[model samples]
Target: MEALNKSFFLFLASRPSLDRFAKRWGSKFGADKIVGGETFEHAVPLIQNLNSQGLRVTVDHLGEFVASEAEARERTLECLQSIRMISAHDLNSQLSLKVTSLGLDINPELVWENMIQIMDEAVKHDVFVTIDMEDSSRTQATLDLYKALKKKYNNIGTVIQSYLYRSDQDLDDLNEVKPNLRLVKGAYKESAKVAFPDKSDVDHNLKLLIKKHLLNGNYTAIASHDDAIIQYTKELVREHGIAKDQFEFQMLYGMRSERQLELLAEGYTVRVYMPYGNDWYGYFMRRLAERPANIAFALNGLFKK
Candidate 1:
């Protein structure tokens, strides 16, 4: 039953027709709770509020899978604008974006050019940029781009999904860069040949990756909502005598609000992954697919206002 729910939402997430319909409604279905806003400007005050509460933030301009160079360029400009805004507002925030939105599929050269523009602005503003991981098929290409960018910029980071069979070795490969990584138990649906087919395996692997990455002495962002995972991290860091500065906790905005605050109160750095923009349908569906508990708020959103 749980698997069926996941697969159903995943299928809904991929439908262009549904995506179009969602845009017409404009974040009406509880998506406004998870999504920051339809634009970065609309999200500015929200970021300020989170910062005031001592919670750091990373804002993603919600979008992906661009099919045109023009669209990709537009995405790049949005990212550039976001960096400048983060700096101008003096907000405690980082920038996160999907490479596909910047022409990863349209053309590599185009994507690289777009990335260089965004990276230049990010560096100038002293804002960190993290390249979000997509599905299994694009993992290597994403990592390759990240490695190239890492060579040129020190304020860059990328996600590593523990569900993938290749992630363990990918960490070793990335260790050379001393990467600042946000470790996640991936969201996209993937074949068992490439991803662990069991939730237990995925959870166990996440713990292992967290341990390996932290002990590797790289900056680690342990992104999870599970209490078990949180407990494991606390015990592991304490046992290893790891410094608090070496790692932090990350959670999607509006999902684990109380836990995020508790962690912050406990002196742990907690970053809220707040995504803004009109292209929110796909992201919203994925959040529902990730945890059925999210559907409650989503349903609540429907009758709201």
Candidate 2:
């Protein structure tokens, strides 16, 4: 049932007409509760509010998998604009971008060029840009892009998903520079050949990865909402004497506010991942895929509408 739910929503997200319709009507069905908002004007106040609460944020302009240069360029520009907005408002947020949204499918070089533009903008404001990892298919290409950027900029970073078998090696290969990382228990529906087939194995690997990085003295983002994983991370930090600045706990915005505040009060840094844009159906669906319990909220939003 869980696998079916993920695949079903992802399939709907791929169809152009259905996606267009969702982009128009999804919020009425409760996407608003998950996605921060549809525009900067709507999202900034929310970022400020979260900042006021002692939680920093990583802002993503909702988009992915562009089929053409035009779509990719439009999406890239919006991300650049998001960076500028974050800086202008002095919001305690940075940029998180998906390469596919910037034209990885159209051409890797195009995506690289778009990245350079966004990275340049982010640097001016001293904000870091973290490249969000997608499905297994793009894993190698995404790493290639991140490595290329690593030589030129320290202000950018990338994610490593524990569900992928290659993540341990991938994280190790970066030891020379110890690039900053956001570790996530991936969301995309993936195959057993490329990803773990069991949840227990994935959870186990998540702890292993977090422990390895934190011990290495690298900046790490523990991006999970699972109570077990979060609690284990806290224990690991205590044992290693890892200061709050060395790592942060990241959760999706609006999903775990009380927990975020509790972590902050405990002196650990907490960052909320917030997505904002008209292109939101796919992003919201992925949130549902990650936590099936959210479907109840989505359904209630639909019924109320």
Candidate 3:
């Protein structure tokens, strides 16, 4: 299975055009079809529907690596606008932002400032913000921005990828200042030197972090569709006697609906990440690479088309 997974990922990486194809197909399927996009306008209705289904939404503006500080400022303002709109609806939706979109690639300080501006708007609207973790190269900058924001806004949170070797220490460091986090097994393709080359190692790290966070009184969001991880998280929650609402079980919008609903039915808080916009191909490609099943399905769809 692992070999198949790696082989499929390699095939995915080689086909850069597949990203464009996925995006076009995704948009044609409408907001219900894919998650993560260029803007949040197309996502609002889908988000409303998910909220109606008793699932919270995390809105993410789809773009990475700003060309300049001005662009980052504009993107930050756009995110704030989305947050304001969600707040107006009084819906169960929050914003997820990428630091690079906020000028981290140009200047770390500019990224921090952009993030602070967005958080300021969030504070005004009483909305929460989650900082999405990027590739390993930007992890330090993302962390710095999160640390700075957390010192000011208690409602601000960030993500930690279990794939990185430094993640354990990163978690410990972040926990010391603020513990609210979204934990994922990671989706970015990275070097074996800096990340766990084996799936077992990443999965093992994910389980360990869940155990550590749940027992340490932190409200960590376990964002995974793996059955064992989900079951383990539930078991840990039960053993630790953590309240159902203390944490949320998060999943991507189109993936593992059965497990998501099952957890929700069991009284666990479930948040569905409903991303939308024009730039969906990049997001879909990442999703396809993350799960071999998704890759197979996508490839079949392509051939059928």
Candidate 4:
């Protein structure tokens, strides 16, 4: 399964055609199963439903790397409008954005401008914004923007991937500001030179990072489904005397329903990352890559018909 998982990641990075298969499956399953939407009008009902279930949500815009400043600015506005809908609906949801999607690749100034706009709007709505970490190539730039924005905005946060060797240092630097962090085991195609290639190493880092956050940070979000990791985190929280609401446990909506609900029922703050958008291929493929069992289940569902 490990070899197959690695091969699937390589295939996703190199073979464009495999995306077609992912797209077909995504179309059948529908976008709401993956991401929110390009517009809040389409995402509000799902967001409201999750909020009703005692779960908080983080909305992601889902596109990345616009080549022109104008395009990026438009996406930024779309995100702002989404925030307005969240406020209107009175939902406990926050916006999660990718800097690349806001034009980081175009010009740093454009990225900063768009970020400032979104952060300002988020503050107006009392909504928080989480800057998602992308590939290693963009990590430094993302961290820089996050730190700068954190200095000016009252409700801005960032994500860190434990799969990278540098994340320990990133956590230490972020400690100076005591920023809110969402820690994930990374979900990108990365090389061994920069990212840990072994699953055990990644899992180890995840546990270590979680322990550090519970012991030292103001607030942290543990975002993973590995049962062992989840159990260890529960133990660490107890050992450190961290209150249930001091941190949150986040999981992808469809990946681990039972575990997420169990955590919530056990009095821990839980958030479901509800992704919905037209571009479901990339998102769905990553889900399959994360666990071959998901792919097998998907394939079996198709064959049964």
Candidate 5:
């Protein structure tokens, strides 16, 4: 039943028509709960509120898979503006972006150029930037781009999905650069050939990845809302004597709001992954697919005044 719900929402996430429709209504139907807002400007105050509460934030521009060079460049400019705003507003925030939105699919060189431009601005503003991981098809390409970028920039990080079989080896490969990684139980719909199809395996694999990455002595972000995963991280770090500064917990904004505060109150670093933009349908659907409980708020959003 859970698997069916996930597949249904995943299918909805891929429909281009629905994406367009959702954009017309703006951030409605409960998307505003998870999504920051329609634009970075709209999100600035929200960031300020989160910062006031001592919750660190990473803001993603909520887009992907651009088909044209012009559109890709526009996305790059939006990211450049976002970095500047984060500095100007003095908000405690980092930038997260997708390479595809910067031309990863159109041309690798184009994406690199766009990234260099953004990284230059990010470095100037002293904002850390993370490249968000997409699906299995782009995993290798994404990592290859990240490796190239890491060589040129120190303020850059990337995500690794535990559901994928190659992620363990990817960690070993990335260890050479001493990566600061966000480990996620990947959200995209992937083939069983490339991903662990069972939830138990996926959860267990996340623990292993968390241990391996932290023991490797790289800064890690354990991006999960599950209490079991949270407890596992706490115990593992205690056993290994890992410094509290070495890792942090990350959760999507709006989901597990209380737990986020609880972790912060307990003296643990908790970063909120806040995504904002008009292009939010795909992202919101994936959130619902990730946890069916999210559907409750989404449904509530439909009838709420």
Candidate 6:
């Protein structure tokens, strides 16, 4: 059953046509429960609502892996506008984006150019942009893009997947810059050669990365839904006398709402990673792949009495 769930969700993540169909006609399946909506205009209120609850937000547009420069530019422009709007609202929201969404696959140079323009816009608004780390294939380019841009702009940040085998060293190499990192338990399908295949190993690595960042005094966002990880982090930092401002916790938009609010109430900053856009298929499938129980959530909607 575990293998079946893994394979089934991965199959969905790999199917773009099915994703498109679901995006167009599958609202009843609980996509909105996770995704913000179809546009920036639609996502603002959602972000505002979370902010009202004392939770910060990192808004992401639901698209990645563009096949053409035109599509990549289109996504890039949307992100630039998002930064402007986020600033104008004075809302407690930042921006996150995928490298592949900016044409990394088509051409790394083009991706870098587009990313620079977006970062330029982010700086004007004083809004930080986080370059989301994709799968292993593009991790090098993602790091390269981040290293290149961090030298040019101080307002930029990027994610580091804890599942990768080299993450410990990656963090060390990036320590000189005091990298602002969002440490995620990686959602992509990865090979054992390059990644920690065991969940236990990934969890350990996640905690290790968190500890290193805090020890180095770098601002880190611990993105996870696991109770043990969160509690362990809290205890670790408490034992080390780490201030609340030193690090923050991040959760996806639709998961663990009570915990997000509870963390905020405890005076810890919690950022909600909220995604919205017409191209939500890929994002939704990836979510399902990461948490197979999400498939059951969708099925419950379909089979509700």
**Mind sharing the TM-score for model 5?**
0.98
The backbone clash count of each candidate, in order, is 0, 0, 1, 5, 0, 0
Query: Which residue pairs clash within candidate 2?
Result: none
Cα miss at 161, model 1 (Å)?
A: 0.6
lDDT of 1 at 93: 100
Candidate 6, residue 34: how far the Cα is off, in Å: 0.8
The lDDT values for all models are: 0.93, 0.88, 0.79, 0.81, 0.93, 0.87
Instruction: Please write out the lDDT profile of model 6 over residues 225-305, one tens digit for every residue.
Output: 888999989998999999999899999988779999899889999999999997877677677766666778777766665
- Among all windows of 10 consecutive residues in model 4, the one with the lowest summed lDDT is 26-35
Of 2 and 3, the candidate ahead on lDDT is 2
What are the runs in model 3 whose C-alpha is more than 4 Å off?
1-32, 36-39, 300-305
TM-scores of the candidates are 0.98, 0.95, 0.91, 0.93, 0.98, 0.96
lDDT of 5 by residue, 82-131 (tens): 99999999999999999999999999889989999999999999999999
- What are the runs in model 4 whose C-alpha is more than 4 Å off? 13-25, 29-32, 37-39, 300-305
Q: Candidate 6 regions off by >4 Å?
A: none
Q: Give per-residue CA lDDT, model 4, range 271-295, as digits (tens).
A: 8887655555666666667766666
Compare candidates 4 and 5 on lDDT and give the better one: 5
Clashes (candidate 2)? 0
98: Cα error in model 3, Å: 0.3
- Judged by lDDT against the true structure, how good is candidate 4? 0.81
Candidate 3's TM-score: 0.91
Task: Sort all candidates by lDDT, best to worst.
Answer: 1, 5, 2, 6, 4, 3
